[model samples]
Target: MCTYATVQTTLEGSAKGPEGSWFAVTDATVYFDHPVHALAEHTLNIDFADPAKGPGARVAVELTAAAARDLLSAIQEALDSAPAELTA
Candidate 1:
């Protein structure tokens, strides 16, 4: 349910970024699908999943496409509704 190939960390980096994907497990069920850019097409399967470490793996971004859009909308709405003083 994720894109990319295999998202990993070196125990000394932030698990937060669009390119630097990070997951917690392998068989982790995600609500949305992750687009993996491989070959000449976008794959939606785990080509490199390390279940030994954890079922939750990061193919790419942590948040799915749907989640990112929802969050961005929420933040924009909040900002639009916030007072001018606070924003300034």
Candidate 2:
């Protein structure tokens, strides 16, 4: 079953896309749905994009549920271990 829930937010960052090129990412779109390329039936999908640049200026990732949870944990750990001043 698809949750059909999506979360989008504005972000200021850079993401490497095709051809080993980097682009400024101004938005993030996260959703859980059927994978476009992954073999899994359903996966967590994240898209970092710069809408002003066009649809091609984007980096996408699709991860299995387990992997997504692991990534979440790793992100939290990395943030937790960082210096408060740097993170703040």
Candidate 3:
């Protein structure tokens, strides 16, 4: 089942693309849907991109529900452990 529910946000960061090059990622699009290549039937998909730099300047990820939850927890843990000044 494709939820088609998408969430978009502005981001300030960089990502390494498939071409082995790093690019500034200015936006993120997250959604739950069928993946393009992952083995999972459905996944939580996230695309980090710089639209001004064209389609190639993008990184995509697809994770199963459990994996996505784990990733969220890991992210929170990392942030939580960081020094307040560093995170701020």
Candidate 4:
């Protein structure tokens, strides 16, 4: 079953895309849905994109549920270990 629930937000960052090119990313869309390339039936999908640059300017990731949770924990741990000034 697909949740069809997507959380979209604006972000400021850079992502390296195809052709070994880098682009500025201004949008982030995250959702749990069917995977496009992953072997799993369903996965957590994230797309970092720059809408102004068209569809090709994007970076995507799809992770299994377990992997997603582990990634989340790792991110939190890294943030926790970093200095407050640097994270801020």
Q: lDDT per model, in order?
A: 0.46, 0.94, 0.94, 0.93
The most accurate candidate by TM-score is: 3
lDDT per residue as tens, model 3, 3-71: 889999999999999679998899999999999999999999999999899887889999999999999
Q: Superposing every Cα of model 3 onto the true structure, what RMSD results?
A: 0.8
Give candidate 4's total backbone clashes.
Answer: 0
Candidate 1 deviation (Cα RMSD): 11.2
Q: Across residues 1-88, which tens digit of lDDT does each residue of candidate 4 receive? A: 7889999999987989979899999999999999899999999999999988898888999999999999999999999999999999
Listing every candidate in turn, what is its Cα RMSD in Å to the true structure after a full C-alpha superposition?
A: 11.2, 1.1, 0.8, 1.0
Task: Name the weakest run of 10 consecutive residues (lDDT summed) in model 4.
Answer: 12-21
Q: What is the per-residue lDDT of model 2 for residues 1-88, given as tens digits with 9 covering 90 to 100? A: 7889899999988999978999899999999999899999999999999999888988999999999999999999999999999998
Candidate 4 clashes between residue pairs 3 or more apart in a chain or in different chains: none
Q: Return the TM-score for each candidate structure.
A: 0.32, 0.93, 0.95, 0.93
